[model samples]
Target: MYLLELYQNNYSKDLVLFETLEEGREFVAQIPGYTLETEDGFDVEYVNPKYLPDYMEIVFNGNIVPLSRFSFNSEENVDIIWKEISNLSVKNDKVIEGYSKIDAYVVNNDEVKAYVEAREANYRKAKDFIERCGYEADRSFFGSEDGEAILYRKCGAEDWHFLCHLDPLFVEIEDVEEYVKEALEEAF
Candidate 1:
């Protein structure tokens, strides 16, 4: 297999796959502003599927998302969801800021809310565990910045003991199908 990238005005426009170099050349002949270049040792079958990106950006219900603000199921009924998302047009010029509120299609506002709530509850539970075990936990200890890996030591003990990386329980949305206007609204 062959992978051909099409760029317009120095920006990536599209990517097309071909079975042979001849077929790829044929496509290049029909289109303008594209150059065909074959890469040496670029065997399609040699590529590892696991290294490929797991997610895709798609538009649905006038919103481009599966908002990165929250994490959910990777698959999420992709075939059906893609059909819906593909129907909508994507705005190439729109800029997405880091975790900022943007137009989004909410699969389930309730699930998103529940996931956040559950994560918070899990943090509290983790703290409780340390206290019950007579251990003092500090997130800033041992150069740990995020609370995900908590540093704990026996109460009044000099040396810091082990790092507690708790696995928090979270609600996973099964599919991307519904649109909840209030979900994304409340998240922001």
Candidate 2:
């Protein structure tokens, strides 16, 4: 049994149980962008952050130039098209020369850069929390049945805290308190 914790955002958390680690990895791959936990030794298609605008071409005096070569400085000889209150035109040297705007077509598409960044940050926080708490999947027998458990404990603590049962069947015991005490005594 495997326990998978997914952090979709900073405020939301989802826990999933899988019989095998492979199943968990397969589920994580279905998500679009790369996550912090998914990057660790997982065989998934990691997506690189792609910038928007298929291509930015600026037309100046019948000459088209890429965005890289276009200058927005005040000293440049250019009249940037602006659609302000009515139509406005600003000439070089910070002067508003005319009251006419440029006719242009705009595409309102969603940007994924910020979303990807927030997702990755949330995943990183989840990973850090797991590490700080020393939580991990471990095989242990509850009562007489063998199963996997997600356990955690305070740093330098001798007792193991049971987080959740990864197995589908919820194995119960008469006294969970005695079990931890017995386990600790045996370890010492």
Candidate 3:
């Protein structure tokens, strides 16, 4: 029962209120609007400025859900990949370049199926496998910067949690193969 404010027309100050984050996201998807940030695909602001003092009222289109609701080991996967990359002694330039390629694919405008095919060919694994392995973690895409890097935590359990953005970059490639293998071994 989260509250979300959606701005339909920025210039006109027209807005719509939603009881759930999903409803706000759906409305935004159906209608085009400008956002104030870039992390969650879009940024939705609050119509009233006083409700949340000292915080800008905005939503990250990518992270509106409570992480406790989902079960995925996203952080572990990222750490595993990071350790693998580190163990391989991968050059910083190579890491940056590799991540850039993944970012490009993520930001691409092509159809989802085409992207999946291309990604799979590049990674040598099916898209479903990647997702199943906790790489492509589930997210709400609420539309805020502070809410961008939310990690999922189990409901009523503070210790068990994982980050959502662990896919694509976690898989090792080329020079980082040995590290990837080690990480995969530990992952299993």
Candidate 4:
């Protein structure tokens, strides 16, 4: 995928995101005067801080001069055109920016029951609380049939999970008594 960035006489901006260079070249050929360029992929953030690309244009005489580029018929007109191009924009793949594992945490069905039974409401708060207590509570994907997914990473093991699934919301824990125990010994 490529970003077909439009420019008119080195002034103005517009973006026509395309899935391939051929698509971009087609758009350029149709609008004679408008110069097209490529930009690196953008992040998934929809509200991009970058300036909007150059506006649309039409080729004037054989050698076009002076920047009298075209404008959208109306805001609706712009919206309609953007509606077509926006989806074509290359969005960054979902990424796990960072990762942390709860190797030293504990989980008991009774203790984390506060989360499991009424799982919906308390999940967020409980998850946040667990993270603040210095452990990533996870249960589901990495879980086993005999047990819920409580991620207890072995000391110095290379099997750390992606930060996305390493959070407390997806897992359960119990033992309300010793929440975030200090100086708990770890077994590799």
Candidate 4 per-residue lDDT, tens place, 1-188, comes to: 45544322333344645566565555545542333333476311111112223453434334332222233221111111221232324464543222222322344433444434444333454445556555565555544323333343334555643222323543443432243232123322
Worst 10 residues of 3 by lDDT: 76-85
Question: Candidate 1's residue-wise lDDT over 8-75, tens digit each?
Answer: 23333234445565655554443222233345954221112232244444343343432221222333
Q: Please write out the lDDT profile of model 3 over residues 1-188, one tens digit for every residue.
A: 23333222222222434545555555444321222334478443322222222322234455443212012222221000010012235434432211222332343323444545544443443223334444442333333332222233323444523333324443223333353345444544
What is residue 116's positional error in candidate 1, in angstroms?
A: 2.3
What's the lDDT for residue 135 in model 3? 48
State the displacement of the C-alpha of residue 110, model 2, in Å, after optimal TM-score superposition. 49
Compared to the true structure, candidate 1 yields what TM-score? 0.30
Tens digit of per-residue lDDT, candidate 2, span 1-188: 45444322232223444555555556544433323333467533322223213445544335453432112222322211112221134233532322321111121113233333443344344335545445432334443343344455555667776644432222223344344445434544
Candidate 3 lDDT for residue 156 = 45
Q: How well does candidate 3 score on lDDT at residue 126? A: 28
Instruction: Sort the candidates on TM-score, descending order.
Output: 1, 3, 4, 2
For each candidate in the order shown, give its overall lDDT on alpha carbons.
Answer: 0.37, 0.37, 0.33, 0.37
Please report the TM-score between candidate 4 and the true structure: 0.20
Q: Pick the candidate with the highest TM-score.
A: 1
TM-score of each: 0.30, 0.19, 0.22, 0.20
Q: Of 3 and 4, which scores higher on lDDT?
A: 4
